[model samples]
Target: MVLQVSDSDPAKWNLALNNARNIQQDLGKGNVAVEIVAYGPGLGMLKRDSKVADRLAQALDNNVDAGVVHIMKRQREAWAYVRP
Candidate 1:
């Protein structure tokens, strides 16, 4: 599953990571793949000094794919358009 984060808030990052963990628990590890794409101000969540850096590291350790889009404006608009 693909999880998109557009905010840099720690709470949002925590919630998204928690949800990913819950899904892994429900479906069994290695059975599912989670891709966390962070753009705009949300890219801060992946930084080393981010408040949720540990959580992001944990997710990475669990084989979750995390990435950041360099073009913020375009990525944000694309995400907005894709969301229901």
Candidate 2:
């Protein structure tokens, strides 16, 4: 499953992490893959200084794939053209 987070809000980061955890628990270890794609301001959630960085680290330890998309400008808007 893919969780797309476009905002830097801590709430969104927490929600995505929780969802990933839920899926992992439901699937019973290595049964499924979870990918978190963060762009725009959301990229901050993955930064070392961010409040949720620990949670992000935990998610990675749990086998969740986290990624950031770097764009020149209007990153959120760029999502509209990203295909699957």
Candidate 3:
């Protein structure tokens, strides 16, 4: 099962990512498929500029399907209120 968490808070985003990694780790000890997508403000967690990118990189390196979609300039302008 894939849990889709959509939130802007970095703390919550980090927690969710870690939780996903832990679950994937345990499940992979046996057999399971898992992935995580961080979009919107949550994308900040995986931002190319964020310090946490290394940790995110590590998770993705471990097979977590971590993905980030570039918010286009138009989308950024339209969603400026929600993005940091």
Candidate 4:
């Protein structure tokens, strides 16, 4: 699944990250395909002083430590963010 985070808000960052974590927890980890792709302001969560840095670290750890989820990516190369 593709989960996109486009805002700089830490709350939105958490919502997106939590959705990934919660999904991994609810449905067995590594069982399903998941991807968190960030773009524009959403990339702030990767900065040194981002408010969601801790949670971001945990998410990274979740992948590095256990290899539960798939790799997290920064959107680029003409990514499609659909608008309805």
User: What lDDT does the true structure give each of the candidates?
Assistant: 0.67, 0.67, 0.53, 0.61
Q: Tell me how far the alpha carbon of residue 56 in candidate 1 is from the true structure, in angstroms, after superposition.
A: 0.8
| Candidate 2 collision pairs | none
Model 1 C-alpha lDDT per residue in residues 1-84, reported as the tens digit of each score? 666678988888887888778878999878876556676788767889999988788777432233444234336655322210
lDDT (tens digit, per residue) of candidate 3 on 25-72: 887735744445555566666666675677677766432333333234
Q: Compute the lDDT of residue 6 as modeled in candidate 1.
A: 80
TM-score ranking from best candidate downward: 1, 2, 4, 3
RMSD of each: 6.1, 7.3, 9.6, 7.4
Listed in order, each prediction's TM-score against the native is: 0.69, 0.69, 0.55, 0.67
Q: Residue 34 in candidate 4 has what lDDT?
A: 51
Query: Local error of candidate 1 at 42, Å?
Result: 0.5
Clashes of each: 0, 0, 0, 0
Q: What tens digits encode model 2's per-residue C-alpha lDDT throughout 14-52?
A: 888888788789986578766667766787677899989
Q: Give me candidate 3's TM-score against the actual structure.
A: 0.55
Clashing pairs for predicted structure model 3, backbone only: none
What stretches of model 2 exceed 4 Å from their correct place?
61-84
Please provide the root mean square deviation of candidate 3 (C-alpha atoms, Å): 9.6
